[model samples]
Target: MFDHIQIKVKDLKSSKRFYTAALAPLGFTVQYEGGGAVGFGPKGAPALWLGEGDSRGSVHIAFAAKDRAAVKAFHAAAVPAGGKDNGAPGLRPDYHANYYAAFVKDPDGNNVEAVCHKEQ
Candidate 1:
């Protein structure tokens, strides 16, 4: 339903590194980079855009993962890329019976998350 999202970060390079690793496990990659911003998504479409600036406020974004393992992988990748662990991978029954997810705070303090809802 959403066309794309743009997040403002204090440092462009650092945000790039954090996102590159964190999203890799979920099959997202940098699709374009120029004009002081970078766009990430599958093959050709860039759904997430990171721009250089001082963030007015922290943003929360959640990507869909194929399964639980992908959620775990995203957490592992995020930590080393300057992300702080917001939540470990687990099934949140409160959200629903099969709501598996993980959360991380990006370098710019954005709340990033990956979630899987398929039954397994």
Candidate 2:
């Protein structure tokens, strides 16, 4: 298991705004903000970290949703917050029978996903 993951962005403020809106539905919030970096996750944990700088390359980060509805909510919330739709919410039988999820490209063009591994 990973303790945390960090990504670099061109603009901290803009990326912060995007993530603030995008991750809300999945129950993640800004956990810490200091040293020109922002941390997001549950109340006290920071699973994802964003720092201001040039992003060398894109990365895919999938967040676990409690259920299918939460996955849908994450997609709905992410789009208007500056995310581009990559994959609509649905089952990926290839990945698995119950791989219900959605994907969006973040401001930095990173693949962000919200997935529920359980059948609804």
Candidate 3:
């Protein structure tokens, strides 16, 4: 539904560090960087952009994971990468069967998640 998203962050460097590590398991990386901004997504296709500026509170951003293991890896990596644990990786039966996901708060406090909806 969206081509790309740009977020204003209080610290671009910290955000970059956090995202680079957190999104790795979900297959995202820095694809572009310039003009005080950085973009993260699959190779050659940057979707999420982060720019240095005053934070506008927080927002939820969920990335698709290939499987439950990726979701768990995301949580394990995110916490040490400067993200705060919002929710541990597990099945969210309320959402649906096989809704495995993990949540973390990014540098600017945005809720970040990696989810896999496939049954194991």
TM-score of each: 0.98, 0.97, 0.97
RMSD to truth, every model: 0.6, 0.7, 0.7
Instruction: State the number of backbone clashes in model 3.
Output: 0
8-119 per-residue lDDT for model 1 (tens digits): 9999999999999999999999999999999999999999999998789998999999999999999999999999999999999999999999999999889999999988
lDDT ranking, best first? 1, 3, 2
> lDDT, candidate 3, residue 107?
80
At residue 18, candidate 1 shows an lDDT of 97
lDDT of all predictions, in order shown?
A: 0.96, 0.94, 0.95
For candidate 2, give the lDDT of residue 80.
Answer: 91
* Candidate 2 C-alpha lDDT tens digits along 20-120: 99899899999999999999999999999999998999999999999999988889988998889999999999999999999999999999999999979
lDDT of 3 at 27: 92
Candidate 1: give the clashing pairs.
none
